[model samples]
Target: MRRVFMIGGAITKFGKHTERNLKSLAAEAISGALADADVAKEALQGVWVGNAAQGVLTGQESVRGQVVLRALGIGGIPVVNVENACASSATALYGAGALVALGEMDVALVVGMEKMYLDDRTRVLSAFSGCMDVEALPELTRNFANQQERVKKGMQRGGAKKKKSRERSIFMDFYASLALEHMEKYKSTQRQLAVIASKNHYHSTMNPLAQYQNSLTIEEVLEAPEVVWPFTTPMCSPIGDGAAAMVICSDEYARRIGARHSVEVAACMIASGEDRSKITESTLSRLAKKAYERAGVGPEDIDLAELHDATAFGELYSTEELGFCPLGEGGVFAEAGHSTLGGKLPINVSGGLESQGHPIGATGVRQLVELYWHLTGRAGRRQVQGAKVGLAQNNGGSIEGAEGALSVTILKA
Candidate 1:
């Protein structure tokens, strides 16, 4: 198999873009990526577009890739539409890399875009409900109710108030439940979660394209309105609209074009969550192990990471699962400053989803764009010193006990 290299990557400022449509957002990112790669639109051999909720959100269902690419004056290419929930764009990158590695395509364009901010906030929240199995939503709701009851009981016992809000998605409840479990099993504190959120917010201040670019203290994060117990509004990723794109090509094409500062795709591993009844390895752990084996690197070798921190707990849990630290020590790891810039292994120097803004389908691709900038010494203020190996973990959708789709991509400078 030929090696795959990312020649260019670009992302729009991730925030609530009420003026942009799907095609316009995609075109902006695609144009930026093409310019960055120094590759003309005519040189692209294939196109992969990642989007999750355009059909429900915008009523544009089929031929999304075709429509978007055609609007950019690119046509007759193998346009593939990918929808893997939040990992949509990352999975598109994985597929594009595979095509290039197999020598089927010399150059491929991967774009992930989503327009999530609609006039109706409830409609926006309802769109996320599609990430789960719709048929099983009743059961899931029951489970959520039970979890809420448990949380209420725990709060009552501790003399804490039960904050209420119907504004957020069910994912927060899921995250809160997972956090409670972590707290119960490992004695992790809400303060630690706040620390992680605050760190990401601080990182965002250095990121011009981040949705929330204000620095947040740990106290502010903890004092913010509670979305779920232990999770302040600052701990969660906001609903946003954005797009990210990248140009990936084979090794020969990279050298032929004299691609400057091209980052090598060491490994792109995609996996599905399994039905595991025990507290053993998670899908992310299994995928990360495979990625390390394929890339001939380990967590110790990874200098930085862009993780799917849709919530602060997501980062904490992923740090442990990715072998950055020992199991159940993610909170401790964050509290010790190991995951911050200039720390041992800086994770989410791009502010992560918590502050960078998670645009569902675009988020995974955005993570890679951040890693590409970091690996190529392009991340200005939030750059990690001496970052050589970078990892991106993007997971999408929720099943009974795991993510429906997960992608782990490792890159080298």
Candidate 2:
């Protein structure tokens, strides 16, 4: 396989776009990326578009990629549409990278976009339910109830009262349950979770494209309204609309085109959660090991990361799963400033999904865009000092006890 390099990357400001449609947002990101790469539109050999809920939310289904690209006067090329919940765009990047690595295409364009801001807030929020197995929701709910009961018992025994949130999403509940388990098993504290949230909030202040630019202190994050126990509203990712795109090409093509400052794709691994009784290894852990091996680097070699922080717990949980720290020590790691800027490994310097806004399909690509800037020394205030290697983990959809899809990408300067 040929070596693949990310020649360019771009992202739209992540927030509610009342007037922009999916195609328009995608066009802006694509144009920016093409310009950044100094590549002409005609040079793109293939296109991959990642979008999760356009059909359910906007009534646009098959041929979504073709329709979107046609508006930009690009056609007759293979336009692949990818949908894997939040990891949609990252999956697209993996697909495009594969094509370049296989020499099937010297240059490819990958774009992830989503228009989630609708007038009907109910409809907009309800769409998240699609990420789960609707048919098995009843059983899932039963399991969740059991878990909640256990949590309540644990909290009571620990001389604490369980708190609940009015916001509805099985995902929040799932994360809360996981947080409770972490707290129980590892003695992690909610205050430590607050530290993570506050760190990301401050990081977003340096990211112009982030949805939330305001900084928050640890006290403020802890005082924020609860979305779920151990998770304040500030700790959770908000609904938003955005688009991100990247231009990837084979090393030969990049060198031929004189593309400077391109980041090499050291590794890109995609995997699904496995089914097993008393599973010992998590999907993220398994994939991270494969990614590290493929990249010829260890977690300690990574200078920065963009994790799938749908919530504060997501970052903490992923830190351990990605081998950045010992299992159950994620909270301690965060509290010790290990995950902060200027620390050992700065994760989510773009503010992460929690502060940058989670635009579903666009999130995965957005993470890559942030890392691209960091590796290239473009990240201004949030830049990690001398970042030479970066990793991104994007997971999407949830089923019983597992993520439906996950992608891990490692890049080197």
Candidate 3:
């Protein structure tokens, strides 16, 4: 099979773009990617777009790619729209890689975009439809009410109750429960998790496209207002608008296309939770092992990484499961500075979804943009010296146990 290579990639600064519509953001990213690849628009054979919440955010449906591409005067070529929740863009790049490897296309443009700050916060959040079973939603809401009732009783013993906004961000409750359970089992503290958020904030200071570019000390991060029990507001991924894109093609095709830099795609892993327990710890275990086998490289071989951190605990548990740190050791690994700049293996130098803003559909592709810069020594202040390989872990869904959708990609310079 032909090896797929990323010729170039780009991402727009992630932030709230209440004024800009979805297509404008998409065009900005695609135009930048095309210029980076040094390829004419007509040379592209196909396009793949990743979007998670356009339907709820913009009332747009399957026509996302068509409309977005049309804004750039590049349309009529085959366009594919991908929606895998937060893994949307990862699947987009993986699909582009597959097409190039299978000889289906000589060149492909993969774009991931989301304009999440469009509707009111409450309305836009309803896009989390994948996390629930529609058939039992009525009962699930009832269960939630009952669960809250139980929580109220438990809190009453301490004269406490949940705020209305607390109930608004119900998914945080799920994530908080996971974090609480992990802490109970591991003796992890809020300070340890705050380090992950703090490090990413500092890392973003070097990232021009990052939303949170200001530096923050661990003390400042830990002192921020708590979003949940252990999570502060700054410890969570921001909601914003942005686009990320990469031009990928076969190695021979890349040389023919004459792009400046090229990175090989060694392994791409996609896993579904078909037969698993809720919060199963097996996704990372099984997927990372398979990825290592396919790429012939282990976690220790990675120079840097970009893992999902929709919340602080994401990095905490995911790093452990990916074997970068032993079980219950991710907090220690993070607080030790191993996951920060100048560390053994830096993670989320694009500031991650936490600081870069989680434009769900655009996030996975942005991870590649971060890796592209790192492997090519273009990450500026966030660059890891002597870096030769990079990895990204993008997961989504909140059913049963842990994250439901898992996608892992390993890249080599």
Candidate 4:
């Protein structure tokens, strides 16, 4: 297989955009990406678009890519639509890179865009519920509620003010259960989770495209209104709308075109959660190992990272699973300030899903856009100095015992 490199990437401001449609948001990001790459629309050999909630929220089912691209006068090429819960765009990037690596195309574009904000909040949330097996949701709902109750009983503490129930996403409950289990088994504290959240909030203050850029303190995060027993409002990702796009090309194509600011696609590995009871290693751990091997690098070689912090717990959990820290020490890892800026290994420098906003399909690609900026020395205030290698971990949906889809992508300057 040939090598691939990302020439350019861009993202729209991530927040509530009820006035905008999918086509408009996509056009802005795609146009910016193409401009950044110094390539015209006609240069794209194929296109991959990722979205998750348009079908449920706006009745836009199939052919989402064609509809959005045609509006920009980009057509007459292979167009693929991808949806893998929150990993939609990351999965799309993997596909585009594979095609380039196999010589199927020289230049390709991958876009992840979503329109999630609606007047009816239930409709927006039902879209999230659709990520899982719809048929099993009946039983899953019961199990999820039971797990929440169990975690609450296990906590045996109270006094957090209750927040609006309508604002809670189903995934919040999932993360809460996982966080509580970690707390119970490893003796981690909610304060550690708050530290993660507070740090990301501060990071977003420097990210103009982030949804909520205001900083919060650990004490403030702890005192915020509770979504679930252990989770406060700021600990969870807010529903938002945005788009992100990337322009990738084969190394031969880049050299032929005299591409100057390209970053190597060292590795992009995507996988699904297997039966954990039968498997010895978890999905993310297995993927991270394969990615490091493919990139000829180890975890210590990473200069910075952008993890899928759907909730603060998601960041903490990923920190350990990705080998950034030892098992059961993610909470301690954050408490020690190892994951913050200018630390051992800065993480979620884009503010992550929690503070940057989680637009489902767009989030995975958005992480890459942030990494691309940092790797190319375009990230302004949040940039990691001399960042040569960056890693992104994005997971989506929920399965019997793990995430429905997970990906680990490593990039090098």
Candidate 5:
């Protein structure tokens, strides 16, 4: 198989891009990545764009990659569009990497863009729901609402009370339900969840490109609005917009057209959550194992990681699943600061999607951008010292509590 290397990667500051649409967002990120990699746009053989809800958000579906490519002034090259909810971007990355590995293309540009805040909250909420298995999610919302009512009652009784009107992301409600089960099975606590949130917040502060650049105290995270029992607003990802793009090329291509930043794609593995039940799927465990198998390195060999931490609970659960910590001990791991920078193996130095904001299709690629900086030692304040091996795990969709679509990538300098 041909070796694939990341020649360049970039993402727009991930938040509400009220100033841009999908095409403009794609152009900006692609332009930045191409410039960063020191490659001309014309050098790219093809482009792949990963997105979900754009059709609902803007009525532009097929040929999305072509439309965006043309708008960006890049000509004639083939463009592909992929969607797998939040995993859409990872899907794009996989396609691009496959192209290089197959020698079908020497260089490929993979981009992920999503615009969610175009309409009011209801419409945005509607679009968000559309990302799920449509049939199951509508029923899930009722279940979420019902559960939130119970949380509200507990709040009325002064158990984790906050004075604001509570809201729950449909995913969170599903997560909350799954998390509550995990808590019960594993004897987890809200404090443990807070530890995860606080850790990501602290790390995000070091990331200039992160959406939330300030640290949050454990107390502040714990005291935030309770969206679901055992989950505060601080623990959840926000609705947002942005774009991420990467230039993937062959090893020879990189040596011929060198750039200041070059991170080798040591291993790239894509897996799905099929056998793992929603209640049983350990997102970290399954995803991490596949990554290690492909990368020829175990979790302990990893110096740092950019994980799929869409919520504080996700950070906790994913850590356990990823083998950084034993099952049911992720909370203990977080409280010890093991996942923070300067710890045994720091994770989410980019603040994660929790603070970085999960812009659906853009999120997976953004995780790669974080991993790129760590591998190349470009993540200044958040740099993991002497880091040579880095891993990134991005999973989208939920089969119960586990991720439906999953990817793990190992990068090295």
Candidate 6:
């Protein structure tokens, strides 16, 4: 495949845009990206749009790409719609990159947009449930019974104050189970999870596009309202509305257009989750291994990253799976400050999903936008100095006991 270059990208502020629709958000991001790339809509050879739950949330079903882009006077191109749960936009990016790499198109636009902040919160939450296997939900949730009891006992022993559980995303329970398992097996503490949350909150203060800019102390995070045993409200990502867009082109196109700040897509790989009982490398680990090998780099060579921290535990677990730290020692790694700014390798400098906001479809593309800024020395305050190599890990949905779909993208300056 030919080399792909990301010439430009942009993201809207991530927050509860209750008044906005998908088209408004997409237009803003797409306009910003086009301006950044110094290209016009006419230059886009094809368009790929990533959105999940749009049909369920807003009743906008198929032809999402054509519907959104057409309103902006962009039409008559091959518009592909992608829905891969949370990895929708990343999958869209992968598609655009592939076509560009294969000489099918020189320039392509990838847009990820989601409008999830609605008055009917139940409907919003239910959209998340749709990402999983509905047929097996009965059996899957039944399995939660035993794990819930085990988690409760463990939390009680750890002296965790019980907070009444409210209606929240089912993913929280999954993360809670993972946290409990990690704690039981590795002796990691809930306080370590709080530390990760606190760090991301602090990092969000530097990200103007982040949904929550207020930094929470570790103590504050620990004392906040609990979503699950070890996860406080601040430790989980909020439902939000946002959009992110990117302008990808072939290396030749970049040179021909005099693109001065293009970031090379060294490697991008997508993998589906396997049976948890297999006991081999997890989905993310296997994907990351392929990405690193294809990029001719290792975890240590990465300067910064934007991980899918749907929950603080998600970040902790990902740090281990991506080989950023030794297996089962993610808590220890964060406690040592290795994953914070100016440390060995900063992770989630954009505040991650916890603070930066996970707009589902937008998150995958938003990650690359953050990394592109840092790679080009444009990240205002949270910039990792001298950042050259960056990685982004985004996963969506859930299978038997793993992420339904996972993607890893490596970028180099």
Tens digits of per-residue lDDT for model 6, 321-358? 99999888998989999999988989999999999999
Per-residue lDDT tens digits for candidate 1, residues 248-280, read 999999999999869999999998778767647
TM for candidate 5 is 0.93
lDDT winner among the candidates?
Answer: 6
> TM-score for model 2?
0.96
**Residue 199 C-alpha lDDT in model 2:** 93
* Per-model CA lDDT versus the true structure: 0.91, 0.89, 0.83, 0.91, 0.81, 0.92
Q: In every candidate, how many clashes are there?
A: 0, 0, 4, 0, 6, 0
Per-residue error at 69 for model 5, in Å? 1.2
Q: Compose the digit string of candidate 5's lDDT tens values, residues 197-236.
A: 8888888787777778778899999888777677787788
Per-model TM-score, in order, reads 0.97, 0.96, 0.92, 0.97, 0.93, 0.98
lDDT (10s digit) by residue, model 2, range 1-413: 99999999899999999988888998999999999999999988999999999888989999888988999999878899999998999899888899889889999999999999887877776778788888987888787778877765666434344354455667887788788878889999899999999999988999899999999999888777767676888899988999999999999999999996699999989987676345888878989999999999999899999999999999999999999999999989999998888888998889999989999999998999899988999888898879999999999888775788999999999
Model 1 residue 5 CA deviation in Å: 0.3
Indicate whether candidate 2 or candidate 4 has the larger TM-score: 4
Poorest stretch of ten by lDDT in candidate 2: 156-165
Instruction: Name the candidate, 4 or 6, with the larger lDDT value.
Output: 6
| Number of the candidate with higher lDDT, 1 or 3 | 1
What is the per-residue lDDT of model 3 for residues 208-263, given as tens digits with 9 covering 90 to 100?
88888988888888667666666777788877889999988898998875779888
**TM-score for predicted model 4 compared with the true structure:** 0.97
Give the C-alpha lDDT of model 5: 0.81
